[model samples]
Target: MQIVFLIEQVVNGLVLGGYYLLIALGLSLIFSVGGVVNLAHGAFYALGAYVSVQLGRHVGFGAAAAVSPVLVALIGIAFERFLLRRFYREDPILGLLVTFGLAMVAEQAIRMIWGAAPLPASLPAALRGPVIVGDFLFSRYRLLMLGVVAVVLGGIWLLLNRTSFGRVVRAGIQQPDMVAALGIRLQPYMTACVMLGVGLAALGGALFAPITTVHPAMGAEILTIAFVVVIIGGLGSFWGVVLAALLVGVVRGVSVHFAPAASEASMYVLMFVVLMIRPRGLLGEPIEKFER
Candidate 1:
């Protein structure tokens, strides 16, 4: 029985890790391309949940989930064009400070518009309750979420590995000046990257809104863990982020079963240990612009 319970927790943690990947991958991508750490990234995530919930009141949950990220991606266009574009290739601290302030403003806006209370998001009755397979049990909704993440992951992998756009982005990460020398403008790519980053974050928020409490500070909460995943996975490695997110999830889940009190702290501990072992992070590679 104890082993069975442990297995269930592992599975649950994997699902949670999938959620973490959606945010961390975007953060990594934006930073890799633009050399800016987006503190406001979580703000987009909060917006996704709020927008989806509001949209859900009108359209169904499925439609709300689909539309919410698109709306947030539109906002990301402005964010990159007006704010982030200026910070690119500038001092890293300046980018951090500006994004941090943006995060504060976004949270306040949410408070003003949505109030401080948590909003309840529900799935359709057909999607609710437990799913059983053999002796293990799972949330029906979470299984669906897992499938969604898998599809997104595959789509992103294909985008980055098999496309011309991805080739330029990759070269830009390693040699922005060289890409410019080749007469390839990167502004469009950076904008698209930011849009995709925030869009992914929003998608995560929208998907998880039903299961998690939606509040103004929720962005901050997830941001901390997302950063943890990024740090553990390395600065710019896709597979690294994926590996780290799953590891963090599994660590936290195992902690819940064996040491419930330490569940929340487990990922941090894992981060600490991994950093000690590999300072650049597991699978983290060197990028030129970030070297200085």
Candidate 2:
């Protein structure tokens, strides 16, 4: 029974980790290339969840889930062009302040549009059942989430490591001036990165909507955990973020089972320990310039 319980917790942890990976992937990409710590990321996620719910009601679950990320990605591109582009040459602190303000604005907008109440989101009928694996049963939707995360991560890895576009992105991260000197356009690439990041956040929101309540303030709550994941994994390291998210998820899941009171606090405690031991984070490289 004890072993069975532990296995169940591990499965639950993986499900949570999938959501973290989707969100953190975008956060890491934006940080790595744009050098911006986007506080509004969670806002994008919340927007996606709300959009998914509304669209789901009108068009069915499949269409809603498919459309949400694409719409959110376009909004992200607009934000990059209108807002983030202007701040690129400014001080990093200024960018942070701008995004922080944007986050607040997004939350208020969500409240005004959706009200303060939580909305219900449900999995499609096809994904509503549980799958039996030995003596354990697992939600099909969660298993689907794991598969989707794997595909996204793998696709991102290929894009970054295998393609010329990825080479330019890596070069830009290391030395933006050199890339600019070579006459490679940086704006488009940066915009793409922002869109990709925002899209991932939106995807996470849509995926998690069924399991969690969707509300105006939801983004603020998840933003804290996302930052913790980013810090523990190390800024700008893709795989690092993935590993750290999984670890945090496992810690949180086990804590919820063994000590419900401490479940919420475990992530902060883990962050504290990581900071005390390695200020740079588990997989993070030392930044030439400090990034928050």
Candidate 3:
């Protein structure tokens, strides 16, 4: 029974980690490639959830999930092109402030559009059951979430690893001046990265909509954990984001079994420990964008 419990927690933690992975990877990329501390990233997530819920009411969850991220991406594109591009030459703090204000405005806008009340988001019938593996029963929806993450992350990896644009992004993060000198032009790529990052946050929100309350405040609620994941994973480290998200998820799950209250603080404690022991984080390489 003890071993079974441990296994259960491990599985549950992986499922929980999926939530963070979906959000944090985007943060990592945006901060890495664009040098933008986009506090508004969380608001894009909220928009995704609200949009998905509203759309799901008519179009079904499949169409809702598929379209929500695209909608957020378009909004993100507009933000990056019209607003964020102007701040690239300035201090990163300005970017932070602008995005922070965006977050506040986004929250208010979400309240106006979606109302303060929590909305219900139901899962498709195919994802609404439990999977029995011997004596243990796991959530089918969660297992489905893992599959979804795998596919999405895989696509992201291919985008960053196998494409010419990926090479430009990689170089830009490490040597922006060099890329600019080569006349590669980074603003378009940066814009794309920002849009992609916001889209990923939105995807995470839409995915979690069924499991949690779909409310305006939900984005703020998840923002702290997302930042912790990025820091502990190292800014812009792909594998680091995945590893840290999953590790924190598992630790939180295990802590819930042993000490319920500790589950809440377990992630921070882990972040502190990782920062103290290995500042760059697991699977992270030093990037110039992370420097002051």
TM-score, each model?
A: 0.98, 0.95, 0.96
Tens-place lDDT per residue, model 1, 1-292, is 8899999999999998998999999999998888888999899999999999999999989999999999999999999999999999789999999999999999999999999999888888999999999999989998899899999999989998999999998988899999999999989998998999999999999998988999999999899999999999999999999999999999999999999998999999999999999999999999977778
> What's the residue-level lDDT of 286 in candidate 1?
95
Please provide, for model 3 over 1-292, each residue's C-alpha lDDT reduced to its tens digit, 9 standing for 90 to 100: 9889888998899888988998899888888876778788888888998988888999998789889999999998999899888877679899999989989999998888778999977888888989999978899888887898999999989999999989999999899999999989998999899899899998888888988989888889888889998888877689989999999899998999899977999999999999999988867887765566
Model 1 pairs in collision = none
Angstrom error at residue 40, model 2: 0.5
Residue 97, candidate 1: C-alpha displacement in angstroms? 0.3
TM-score, ranked from best to worst: 1, 3, 2
Q: Which one wins on TM-score?
A: 1
Whole-model lDDT values for every prediction: 0.93, 0.88, 0.88
